[model samples]
Target: MTRRVYFDHSATTPVHPEVVEEMCRFLKDNFGNPTSLHYFGQKARKAVEEAREKVAAAIGANPAEIVFTSGGTEADNMAIHGVAYTNRNRGNHIITSAVEHHAVLNTVKALGKQGFTVTILPVDQYGMVSVEDVAAAITDKTILITIMHANNEVGTIMPIAEIGRLARERGILFHTDAVQSFGKIPVNVDELNVDLLTISGHKIYGPKGIGALYIRKGTRWRQTLFHGGAQERLRRAGTENTPGIIGLGKAAELAMANMEQEAAYLTRLRDRLIREVTEKISHVRLTGHPTKRLPNHASFCFEFIEGESMLLSLDLQGIAASSGSACTSGSLEPSHVLLAMGIPHEVAHGSIRITLGRDNTEEDIDYFLEVMPPIVERLRAMSPLDQETEFALSDRCNGCRVSHTCRV
Candidate 1:
């Protein structure tokens, strides 16, 4: 049997054993509605508050500021739409990057249909958003600026602190979807100076269907996304996902304790993957920032082949990987992130994203290196794109803007 390896940690991670263990007690023993005033209810409520504190401490936030939601999408919507409606009288404009996850892009697009003006800032060839563009996009009517902390598809970390400072100076509320960066890197709400931030549980080795939005205590925001009994301090309305919340809290605790050490380990493996894959494969280009990217993320585009084909071939070899954001993978179109970074449509169609996690080892990377080169070569041979001649003449490399550094 082929050894199965998972290299799609950016899409989601397996729930940690400790997180599962921490949540089991809530499902069986403390199964009571947190809103009820009974003894069991009080016990559940206490557990919920404790979990809030754990998540808060992980991101330098106060417990009152943590509003639990179903997942990152809902948290993102709540932050953007909540602020849009709450502060409509103050402004009707939003500023965000062109490379944001669909969650932010779609939410802001929906707002645009409702009479709000939006400024979608462009990114450099390396997928880094320009802080100057952000500053220039802001206007007196710009009420919010929502950019991702680290891009899901390419793993480029944004200059969020600088952008946040600009937003602060301009008196604009700032929000960031930290789903990809929360556990993988250090994210302090104070240091980023963000007015609101979103985090998903599954991205951090916790249960799915659980996430949180951190709204600075004095930030002008309202909970208009849902209307129901006053749960989440009247911010999000639904019976709390008690078990998932417990799991998320446990995951956050574990991340806070081991993040630094784990980052170093993942970075080494990630760089090794990058070096081996680029050196072994021909007509390949690394996407995203070469260095200012996530420690665990390695992305590339191989010419003369499509991403879906490479993904399918890798799967048969018992490796789970991705062509782009899992949320957008169903689409046949090329990645918006790669396109935004000025990669041609043909090149962007061949992109692959390999994100590492705590469970990965050097042996796993070695296994991948052993299998990946042949796969790309096989695909290139079968392709009608005429790799040898076309690849030499096409100037696609020079057009990609990374040709000077790309090993190919």
Candidate 2:
């Protein structure tokens, strides 16, 4: 059997064994509704609170500030839309980056339809957004600024701390989609100066369908998508996914214990892959900030070939990689994140993202490096519209006809 190698950690990670063990115990032995007032309910409630505390400690936030949600998308939607609706009287303007995840971008777009004004700031060639641009976009009516902690597709880490400081000075609320950076990088809400942050469990090797949002104390917000009996401080309304929450807590604990070692290992593997691809492939361009990016993320674009083709070829070789965000994969359109970074349409369509994780090894990377060049070459040859040759198709046809003078 062919060995399957997964390089799409940015999309989601497999639940760790410890997380699964913790969750199974809660699911089977500790089954009870957290909202129930009976003994069974009390046991479940204790589990939820313990999980909450674990999540809070992971990010240096208080347990009271963490509001559990179904996942990162829900958390992001709640933070962005909640802020917009609740603070409408203060302002109708919201600022964000062009490269945010669809969760943030789509929510802001929906807000725009309902009389809210949105300003989308652009990034540079290296995929880094300028704090100055964010500051300049702010107005008296600007109620909130939402930027991603790190770009999902390109792995660019935004200067959230700098932007947070600016937002705080202006009394504008700040939120970040930290799904990509939270477990991979060390994050402290106080250190970043952010008003709110979003995290997804599956992205951090926890179970899917569980996530959390950190809302700073004193930030008043209305719940836009819930109806229940005062659970989650009335901010979020739903029966807690006790098993999933327990898994998340275990995952968070494990991450905190081994964050440094995991980072160092993944960084070494990521750098080696980058070096291998760049050296072996011609006309390939690396995306994102060279150094200030995720330890596990390595993104690049091979000019003149469609990203989808490259991804499929890798998949055939038993390697799973991504052409863009997992959310936008099946669509024909190029990645909005790549377009926002000012990459040309053709180049953006040629982009590929390879994210590493704890499960990867040096041998896996070496095997990928060995197989990648031939795949790129084969795809480039098969492409009818390759731009490598300077002459037009007609010019090349003329030469072919001359070489085979009377063949026809």
Candidate 3:
């Protein structure tokens, strides 16, 4: 059997062994509701609080500020909708970037339908949202400024700290969907100056179906989305996902401990992959910012071929990767992130994202480099556009302008 290599860590990572072990303990022995009033319940409650502390400490936030949710999507929805409704009287305007995850973009669009004004700020060619544009978009009516910490597709890091500081000065609540940046980058809520932040467990080698939202203490936000028995201090309702939360806490602790080393390793592999792919392949262009992107990510666009075709070819060679954001893969449209960065639809259709993980090594990267070039060449040869270009070039001889059959 061919060994398969996974380069889709940005979509989701495998749960760490430590995280799985920690979760198993909770599932088997401590199977009590945190809300129940008994010894078992107390034990479960203790675990839940400890997990909250771990998550909060990971981001330099207060334990009380972390509210658990289903995943990044729910976390984003909670923050945007929670603040939108809670502070509707203060203002009904929200500001965000065009390259944000659909979690934030769709939620804001839903709010627009409900009569809330929304400003979708554009990004630069490198998929970077300018702090100046964000500053200009703010208004007295802008109640929330929710931008992502980093773009999931191109992996371009945003200017969250600058935007956060601006939001603070203007008295507008700032939120960041940091699902892709939390474990992969140094994300301190205090450093970013954000009032609200979102994180997902699976993105950091924890279990899926569990995530958290950081609502700064005394922030004017409310639990307007979920309505049920008090949980997450009434910020999110329903029984706690005890096992998933425990796994997330364990994962958070592990991430904090190994972040520096893991980032360096991934960065080396990521840059090598980018260097080799762009240098060896013709008509290939790196997609995101050259140096201001994620340490574990390298994305690119190959002319004269479709991303799906290259992905299929790579899959046949036991290499797994992604064309763009996994959430929007079902759509036939090109990536909104790429398009927002001024990438033409034709170019965006051929984009691919390679995100590394803790388990990736130099050998894995070398294997990818070995298999990827031929796949791109194969796809390009099969492309109708490439065929047309080839015929056109053959017809127009370089040596002589008059002769149509000058083979040079």
Candidate with top TM-score is 1
Indicate which candidate wins on lDDT: 1
Whole-model lDDT values for every prediction: 0.91, 0.87, 0.88
Global lDDT for candidate 2? 0.87
Order candidates by lDDT, high to low: 1, 3, 2
Off by over 4 Å in 1: 388-408
> What is residue 304's positional error in candidate 1, in angstroms?
0.6
lDDT of 3: 0.88
Q: Extract clashing residue pairs from model 2.
A: none
State the displacement of the C-alpha of residue 207, model 3, in Å, after optimal TM-score superposition.
0.1
Better of 1 and 3 by TM-score: 1
For candidate 3, lDDT tens digit of each residue in 112-193? Answer: 9999999999887788888899889988899999999988998889889999999999999999999999998999999999
Better of 1 and 3 by lDDT: 1
Q: Which stretches of candidate 3 lie over 4 Å from their true place?
A: 386-408
Task: Please give the RMSD of candidate 3 to the true structure.
Answer: 5.3
